[model samples]
Structure formats: structure tokens, C-alpha cells
Target: MIQYELQQVTQQYNGKTVLNIKKLEIESGKIYGLLGANGAGKTTLFNILSFLEAPASGQVVFAGQSVFFGRTELHKLRRRVVMVDQYPIMFTTTVFKNIEFGLKIRGMTKERRQAVIDEALDMVDLAAYRGASAAELSGGETQRLALARALALSPEVMLCDEPTANVDVENQAVIRALLTRVNLETRCTILFTSHDRLQAAGLADETVVLEKGELVDTSYENIFSCSLESKGKGQKICLLQQKIPFSLPGFVPEAEGRDYRVYLNPDKIKLVQGGQQVQQRRGVLFGTINLMMAEGEKVRLIVNAGVMVTVLLPVDEYAQLRLAIGDAVTLKLKPDAVEWL
Candidate 1:
């Protein structure tokens, strides 16, 4: 079922358009990662979805019901949809009380409230901190408390805006695990925004990119904007910062002088030692590793050949290579790896 639908949604500030989405539909019981750079209208879109701000023009449909701005129906819709901000604010009380506050407002019985609060706390691994003061909780604990509060409501839809943005690495992993578990066990529709490409890829069932207040593409992480440098052998090769030149297969630009966007999947690129030679197809570029980090089962490497290129290798392959930061590596780009956007 389609949980939420936006039609011609547009928001403006002082006569200047901020968000202009033609049509977007959020499905039920799925995790969606809203990926974008800063000021990409991500928060504006979330505000409209959460009903915190009315759009300049557009209509939102929830569960097959059309939602109107400034109407009582919106209040009813909000009951099923909850939002957790980037920096969540906690009540000046105990963790149990903070989670119980919403339950009490819904007229839950004393016994039922305690049960639900306990379940939520356990879900976030905060059962031991139930009686602790909310003000004394760390950044991760506070965010987890906010998540527990939202979970206790048993909302049908949850909107998370950078839930782990301000937390440490360990906390980020904890929150990610909690989100995955919640979506799996409760089947709640989760829509979250993150600027981290690897995080979005790991968590979201599907990813959408927003650029300059407009929906760019679903494969946002793989897309690159570049200008064509030259053409040869029926293929157009583009140079990224006059260093890395890769051919664009079956892509003929209308104007050679203009810039174009292309998509290259990170998984398709193979990373090898600097002196290795592999013949047959595609191209190879040597570069020093700028950064390397473990992302789930894969190791994400940022290579600075000319422009920074992202490559992901399985843990087994990465372990065999024994790669590290500042080490030189060669990237093998397959011909079929590059796609026109």
C-alpha cells in the first residue's frame, strides 16, 4: 500500500521557490533513504510531510485519504505519522517518564503504559537507564530515547532526519541496527535523510537524491557531473579534473562543450594493488588511497587519482589486499560499469 503520496508539492519562501516536487510516493513497510547535500530541501520536504509547515501549493494523500492543510484531518493523520528530528529534545525528567508522556496523552491504562514503555526501552537497549534522568543521558542515549518514544506510539510511518548525525561512530551503528530491527519486526514505514552515501546504501531499501530543491535521481550516489574532454573510437571520454579520463559507451552528447551527468556504480569498480596488471577490457587508473573505512560487509575506499573516486570491495577481497590509507592502488573500471544519467 502507498503510505504517503505528494502531488505537485511546492514550497516557497519570500516568493522564492525552495522545494518543487512534481510527484513522489512513499510505499508502506519499507525503508527509504532520502540522500542529499546540505540545503537540498530535505528538511523542507520533511517539514511538509510531518505537517509542521504547509506547502505553498500541493496535496498530500495519506493511506488513500487526501490531507488538507489547516484541517482537523491533518491532526488525525499526524497520529499515525511521527517525526524524530536531527537533534532530539528530551523532557526534563526520567527516561521512563519521557516515553510514557505520549502514552498517557493517548489515555493508555497504567499497566499497559508500563508494558509498552518497557518494551520500547528494551528495543533500544536502554532498559537499564529507564529511571535515569533524561538530562544526564549522552547524545546517543538521548537519540535512542527519542526513538523509543516514537516506537511506543506504534506509529504507521516514521520520519527520521539525520538521527545519528551528531552521535559518535559507535552510536551510529547502534541506531542503524535499531532502525533495521524496527522496520523488520514492526514493519513500520521509515523515511530517513542522510548525506552519507554508504549509510544510505546500507540502510535504505531504495535511495532518492535531492539536489537544489529538486528530485534528481534515485541512483544519486553513483551519479557524477562532468564535462566531456574528447571523443575517440566511437566513444566519448570525459576527464574528471583533467586527471581521470573514462569513456562513455553509447552516449553521444548533443553538444560536446556542455557538461553532463553520468552514473557509475561503486561496486562495479575493482580495486587492486598498484603494480598489478589485468588485461582484456575497460581501463585502469593508479592513485593513492585517501581514505578507507569498513562499511558493513564491504570496505569503502576513497582513491585520489585526480578526482576522488569511491570504490567498495568485499571484506574478503579487502583483507587479501591488505590495503590502508596512504597506500597506492589501481582502480579497474569495467566498460559496462559506467552508465549515462
Candidate 2:
């Protein structure tokens, strides 16, 4: 079931357009990862979904009901959809009180309120800290408290905006596990935004990439624009980059333009030590590591050959190789791994 749908949604700020998505459909009971860079209008999109900010011109439909801006009925809808901000705010009170306040406002009975609060605390692994002061908790604990507060409400949809952005690695793992458990057990539809690609791939059932306030294909991660030089046998497309001519088989474009885009999944690229032979019959390119960074349990590496290529591998594999910045490495690209975009 589609829980939320946006049609011709366009949001503006000071007469300047920010988000201009034509259409988007969010499915029910699935964890979705919203990915983008800073200032990519991710937060704005979240606000629109949470009904905190209305679009400049568009329609938002939640659970088959059309939601209009400034409607008193919106408050009722908002109650079913809770949002956890990047930086959670805590009232100057005990953690148990903070989680109980929302339940009290909803007129939950005293017995039920205590039961739900206890369950929420256990869900976040904060049962021992329930009586502690909310303001004195660590960054990770604060985030867990915020999540506990949301969970106490028993919202149907949870919109988390970078829930683990400011937490340490240990806390990040804890939050990720908590989210996964919640989605599986409670069947709550979760939509979360993250700047880390690996985190999205790990936590979300489906991932969407946002660029310049518009939804872009996730394949754009490895897409490269190049002019087609010639066609080889079996309708192979030869790109004009390296003299060795990298050709993709069974892909022929009918268009007349020579310029085209090709996509390669980061996982498809295999990295080998320099001077090592590729085990498979794959196209090999030698390059220097331009940049490398840890993404959760994976390491994302940017290699500079004739063209820049992105590669992802397990952190354990990277550590075993003992690779570092400016290291020379050989990348193996299988013929079937390349796809035309």
C-alpha cells in the first residue's frame, strides 16, 4: 500500500524554487533511505512530509486523503506521522517523564502509559537510564530518548532526518539495529535521510537519491558521460576514453548522438594489488587512489585512471590489502558489469 504520495510538489523560498519533484510515492511498511548532500533539500522534503511546511504549489496525499495547507485536520494527520529531527531536543525533565508526556497528552491511561514507556525504553536499550535526567544524557542517549518518545506515540509512519548523524559509531550501530527491529516487529513505515551511501544500502529496503531538490536515479552514483567512438562486433559500444577502447556488449544505442552515459555499480569493480593478475577475464585498468574513506563497514575509494572511477569493498578486505592514499591499484571491471544509462 502507498502510504504517502506527492504530486507536482514544488517548494520555494524567497521566490526561489528549492524542491520541484513531479511525483513521488512512498510505500507502506518499508524502510526507505533518502540520500543527498548538505543543502540538498532533504530536510525541506522531510518537513513537507511531516506537514510542518506546506509546499508552495502541489498536492500531498497521505493514506489516500488529500492534505491541504493550514487545515485544522492536518493536526490529526500529523499525529499519526511523527518526525525525529537531526538534533533532538529534550525538555528539562527525567527521561521517563519525557517519554510519558506525549502519552499523557494523547489521553492514554496511567497504566497503559507506564507500560508503553517501559516498552519504548527497552526498545532503545535505555531501561536502566529511564529515571536519569534527559538533559544530562550523552549524544547517543539523547537520540535514543527522542526515538523512545516517538515510539511511545505508536506512530504509523516515522520520518527520521539523520537520526545517527551526530552519534558515535557504536551508537550508530545501536540506532540502526533499533530501527530494523522496530520496522520488522511493529510494521511501521520508516523514511530516513542519510549522507552515507553505505549506511543507506545497509539499512533501507529501497534507496532514493536526491539532487538539487529532485529525485535522481540511484544508478547516478556510477554514471559517467562519454562520447561513443565506434561499435564493435555483437553491437558492442566502444567509448572514446582509453586507447584500449572499453566496449560493452549487447548494448547499441539507436540515437545519432555520439555522446552517451554509462553506469557501473561500485560493487562490480574489484580492486587488486598492483602487479597482480585479474582472476577473471575482465577489463583491467591501472590507477592511483585519489581518495579513500570509511563508509560504515565498507570503504569507498575513488581511483584516478584515465577517468575517475568509484569502488567499494569491505573494510576487512581494505585493511588486509594495507592500501592507503596515493597508492597504486589495479581495478578489474567485468564486461557484464557495465550498463548504459
TM-scores for candidates 1 onward, in order: 0.75, 0.72
TM-score for candidate 1, residues paired by index: 0.75
Which candidate leads in TM-score? 1
Tens digit of per-residue lDDT, candidate 1, span 1-341? 99889999999999999899988999999999998878889999998888888899988888898878766867777778899989999989999999999899899999999999999999999999999999999999899999999999999989999988999999999999999999999999999999887788789897778877888754466566777755556555676544456654444465677767666678888888875334323467667999787777988888876767788889999999999898888877776777765
What would you estimate as the lDDT of candidate 2?
Answer: 0.83
- Tens-digit lDDT track for model 2 on 1-341? 89999999999999988898888999999999998867778999999999898999988999888898667877888889999989998999999999998899889999999999999999899999989999899999999999999999989999999999999999999999999999999999999999876678778988877877998765336565666553435344445343334544345576644666666778888899775334322366677898887777889898876677789889999999999888888887775667775
Clashing residue pairs, backbone N/CA/C < 3 A, model 1: none
Off by over 4 Å in 2: 219-341
lDDT of 1 at 160: 97
lDDT of each: 0.84, 0.83
